[model samples]
Target: MVIVLSAGKLILTPTELLCRLSSGATLRALPDDIRLVTTPPLLIADAGAVSWTLPLDGVECLDDITEFYGFAKE
Candidate 1:
């Protein structure tokens, strides 16, 4: 999935710690309702809606820098 960020770019993975953070999406503690079992590529809409094609089965938390791609971080 690919989410369009405010920076006018696309966030390919919603579960990526870096992508989520860079996109300005707050990452709170894991909620009982939500479980991060797997870190799959996610696509979020500019409106903040999240969607993923793969199953999230074993994901825990996102890191500060998940993976650097495309543009360099300032």
Candidate 2:
């Protein structure tokens, strides 16, 4: 699980190891030559940094993110 700041709030979201391999909206060190499957289209900057908003709420737990990504802790 990874905590990301989105829309001014800290949201706990599932982090997939493979996601790191895919190219993001931000031109970070991600692999750009390959296509991705079943992944959320990320908003990235040219610098390879992810573009996210911090939510108004405080830090969230992984359980709270299940609805968004259908993730379940193993």
Least accurate 10 contiguous residues by lDDT in model 2: 29-38
| Per-candidate TM-score against the hidden true structure | 0.19, 0.21
Model 2 Cα displacement at 69 (Å)? Answer: 0.5
| Per-residue lDDT of candidate 1, residues 1-74 (tens digit) | 44334433334343332234444554422121132222362322222354332222222211211232222122
Worst 10 residues of 1 by lDDT: 56-65
lDDT against true structure, model 1: 0.30
| Candidate 1 TM-score over all chains jointly | 0.19
Instruction: Score each candidate by Cα lDDT.
Output: 0.30, 0.30
C-alpha root-mean-square deviation, each candidate: 12.3, 12.5
Candidate 2, residues 39-63, lDDT tens digits: the string is 2322221323443221223324333
